[model samples]
Target chain A: MSSVCLSMEGGSAASTPAALPYYVAFSQLLGLTLVAMTGAWLGLYRGGIAWESDLQFNAHPLCMVIGLVFLQGDALLVYRVFRNEAKRTTKVLHGLLHVFALVIALVGLVAVFDYHRKKGYADLYSLHSWCGILVFGLYFVQWLVGFSFFLFPGAPFSLRSRYRPQHIFFGATIFLLSVGTALLGLKEALLFNLGDKYSAFEPEGVLANVLGLLLACFGGAVLYILTRADWKRPSQAEEQALSMDFKTLTEGDSPGSQ
Target chain B: MSSVCLSMEGGSAASTPAALPYYVAFSQLLGLTLVAMTGAWLGLYRGGIAWESDLQFNAHPLCMVIGLVFLQGDALLVYRVFRNEAKRTTKVLHGLLHVFALVIALVGLVAVFDYHRKKGYADLYSLHSWCGILVFGLYFVQWLVGFSFFLFPGAPFSLRSRYRPQHIFFGATIFLLSVGTALLGLKEALLFNLGDKYSAFEPEGVLANVLGLLLACFGGAVLYILTRADWKRPSQAEEQALSMDFKTLTEGDSPGSQ
Candidate 1:
């Protein structure tokens, strides 16, 4: 079952600007661009935002773009970007970033729900809401599971090793779902808020479309980084790391370190 | 740098149901399910498909869901599923699947534009249209480049090997974009057709929302398959496959074979 084309996987030239950093930087740029565009769409065209008012609904998109999409993307990048950092430090930073994302995302959820209830509008009826709520719920659950299994140190080394791939798979999948959900929300926003004007290429509509494209591009960049076998973190002394007792013997003090 | 945690990446045990087959089967099930759902949506709810009448627009979604989403996904899975097949046969099968996808997708594109022209509905104004068109355009270009580089047998071995990663990256990324655009189109379809009924959870709206979720799950499964390092196509042989004279000396007649 060994791969037949491992050597054909190309390598980056030493003299070239490192591919990983470039992609990481590009992802960050697109991330902030979409977040900023979402903010502008809310502030400039949507009458801005506030707590407990119609404007509060504006906070929802802005916060989602910021917290769920932007910050969440960065959190996933923690290990990749800080590859040389002590694994323990990277794990904490990773968890911390996710905490911030979850908190902010919670506020975004509240903003929409609060607005919906105040206006007597039904909640969770639209596809956008369904996708969004699923993403958020999955995000929370993923974090809880991730923390307990990977960060809390209670898991047996064998178990942790076993669960690692599933964790990464789900993490990557959920991040993608967040991106897809954000795009769904964009369509909902344009149609619900802009209406016929969205069809006429109104500035707000154009901005939102651009935002949607940017989000997909950001997601693609991240996925590209992730799937590039060359970009994966090195298996430092892979055999020892794989050894059943290595984690307990050498890293027991930091039992949960990645 | 090598990954510091390679051993922890985990592997499927021999006793388990072979995971690759399970994921590949699961992806196919989701792909066919969503394609069937799309057909049902268009035929039952959206008035059905034709060439030049108002019903022509129905062809757009149905063909796209089948050709672009389902067939294209299966095309991407060709390498992984046919791992032991003769490389020449697999390459031809891959290209042929894509050719079929392009033709079908082209018909779908024509259906939309023709319908728009007939109805005097402005085209490419909405985010859905913009995203959908972009995906189609890129799909064409990707197919062209992939054929010439990997199927036509004209490129140098070094060049083909180098471009392989980019090809794989773009292919995966474009597949994802196709899925994203479909979700956007679903939102537009629901809003444009269902309007207020969508908010009321009309059957059509609920059906489309389910389709959207299914599309996402299908995309995720394909992606999971794509990104699993364990699932990557093997190198046939390391030094030989990567050797500068690999094709010229050993397999020139099958120069484009994977």
Candidate 2:
């Protein structure tokens, strides 16, 4: 088995398996499946999708799951999954996926707001809404900084090095916040329907709860794969094959090399 | 300024500050304050505390915040805070803190269950309860495994080394689950009283929402400090002062020494 060297802070390699591609791929498939299942739960059981009214509320969960959970996760995994590929290509894919997630999440927010306005319900009223809005706002800022610093017209090598840790920190934080918000949203939706045949123990309620649990599980797995020191992307000699047009590339080199 | 060598896995030291005592202490104080504030909001603003009936419900949040949010966080930080201290002592403190957290959490669970039983309300009837119970169950298992494998009469060195990563991963996962559960419980409590003077926009409702936000922030900060590589405990030269009763002690030695 080929071993990958994990580079911590641009130096000091720790050997782990380079064969994590399959694991990353598997997590992606499982995470996407769970997101799809949650959407189906809403579309089939709760109410069919529609542009306005209660049906519009369904779009909120569906879009948020697809965008925040699936797409954003894929964005984070781009580096690990494409470890052998050119660094520039993986960086492009990461930025692009985040953009897509942002657009979809915005649509999700609009859907919920429209529904609330039609129903004469107050906006930003619940903890779920508050968290959802906060995550979205932070995601936007993260995207902006990432794009400007790492993607195009990148920052100075010193600046990029300083920001790298913060970038990873906030990225993981926002993802966790999204997952937490989704769970709270699901609870609110389920509780609103509770009573009569649709109590918390009923099949529909159970399915919703299971969806929330799955979201948490998916999130936990994704984070484990992302944050584990053993699972970090290996810095190979081939990484230098990519043109060093961006000054920030120097940040990854050992200080002795300078 | 003293620099602590961050030993990843068993070897390869990277120097970072040994001066993180302030950061750790500050986070602990701030985290506990947030937990206390959340509980106080429930007790003082919503309704005063009582031993039986609806008033007894106040004990649930108060105890849960103290146990799951504050105490559990402290348990996770023991290793980092006592990095220079004896490993055995830190491990014992870690386990003991978990035990205290578990006891307080059990009391919190009983408080809610008693209230429900007295009011003839259905049990395990909300997403919050389901998640809360699941977290508690997993926590029990985590504690058992940690105590048996890492503390007294600990497992073989090989086993302990293998289990270290899993222990850290699960510890973080359970803590996040607790925070998520707390947020869901807050939402449920607030919504149940939303139609009356406790409307979402009301002062009490706003305080409740802020408490949920604070819990999220506190969890994020705790996880950041715990997970950051640079913030890991330094393997001091004096670590060898302890008896080599456990074979795992050799793991931290440089590979050349081995």
Candidate 3:
């Protein structure tokens, strides 16, 4: 086996695998699928909003069906990738990502179903369009990151690889941004749907103000995550080993090459 | 090496360990964390208008500090566990989670430092008091989940093991209810904080309406994650195996034992 494969199989290496990062990236994308399902649910529950009428879709029923479908697919994928695995650390990581995917899909299902049942408003889409954008954007970002990995042979940031670190750094940046956007979008969608009932419950509007502040904070968190983490540049020797073909390169060529 | 260790060494076990369920449980908690953080950020920006003022605190500053500390600790743990090794799978998982932690921390930092830079808002907590509630509630939720893990060795679907999943189920339900109540409280907060800005932005009450809908979705998402992602209770035999010490318990006692 190649050293990279050996490292992965032996559990003696320091880095996580490519499949794992893609797994996380994909997990984040599940949030988008939730938005889609939620939107569909809201439409159906409200008996199909006037605005969405022209879209040739029934909201509530479609939401339930599609949401369930997405949930199953996402959950199954996560299970296939993470469950019943061994190798303490790796299993833990993959398992966590799997859970995240399942959670997001579940949330999306609820959001859509509840909206459909409550029919709380006329146009769920007008105000909540941002949520859809967030979900779609997140998935797109993950796809890009996952697709990028196929271009490279081994993991990033290894003594034998230079691009690995950069890939990680950029990939993370994309994920955080996507998350922030999703949160913002979700808030906007909710507010648009139920602002009137909210006023009657609280004469002062304290809740709206507080939620707005929270959105700002979440946005800040996204920014913080972006700036603090970076791909560490490789040392000179490490860089060279990463450049040469493994077949032609001597093991001694790089002193720190593990 | 112990046979138990060997069985789990390559991380190839077909059955999930107790830790697996907790990891899955953590995912649900983390989803709530995301929602809470999002709400907290919005509250800090708009003030604690979305929910109860009693829940308010300096969400931005406190979050920044706590988030950073956690990120640091998490990163160190990851590095210690995975760094300098040469495992593809390990490396990928480590890198992704590390990035996730860092990105979230960074977003918090940005919100904190940028408080003074914003145009409309004069002070940090000027947004609303209810936002404090969101931060408070979210942190409390996070603490509750983490402590539950400490209290219960098994999570998600465990019938026994100190902390019953029922208690967790109730706690999560209560948290979701609190979010709904907070949403109903946000109307006045949005009216006062947004004022003319609210009017200027919309088709007569569009902004508030949108905010309401988004809050509804947020609440909906919370409910979904708590209820849906929870693992189903294992079969009697499976549960028995799960409860027993894998190493000490002989397979002869249970016909179905793996």
> For model 3 chain B, where is the 10-residue window of minimal lDDT?
B1-10
lDDT of 1 by residue, B166-251 (tens): 89889988888898888888888888898878778899989999999999999888888877765655444223334534554356
Clash counts for all predictions: 14, 0, 107
lDDT of 2 by residue, B1-258 (tens): 111233554333334345466777778777877877876786677677787557888888888998998899889988777666667777789999999999999999999999988988888856788899999999999999988777646356667667878899999999999999999988888877764444348887888888889899889878978976666665452344235533544554422212
Model 3 chain A scores worst on lDDT over the 10 consecutive residues at A1-10
Name the regions of candidate 3 deviating beyond 4 angstroms: A1-41, A49-142, A145-183, A199-258, B1-192, B195-258
Higher DockQ: candidate 1 or 2? 1
DockQ of 2: 0.31
The CAPRI category of model 3 is: incorrect
Estimate every model's Cα lDDT from 0 to 1: 0.79, 0.78, 0.37
Residue lDDT tens for model 3, B1-258: 000001212222232333434544453455445445545645555454211232222344334323422232232233223322332333345345534544554554455345434433433232222443454455445445544442223333222333443334333333433333334334434444564455345443454445444444444433333332112221333334444533223433422223
Top candidate when judged by DockQ against the true structure: 1
TM-score, per-candidate, Cα-based:
0.88, 0.87, 0.31
Poorest stretch of ten by lDDT in candidate 1 chain B: B1-10
TM-score of chain A of 1: 0.87
TM-score of 1: 0.88
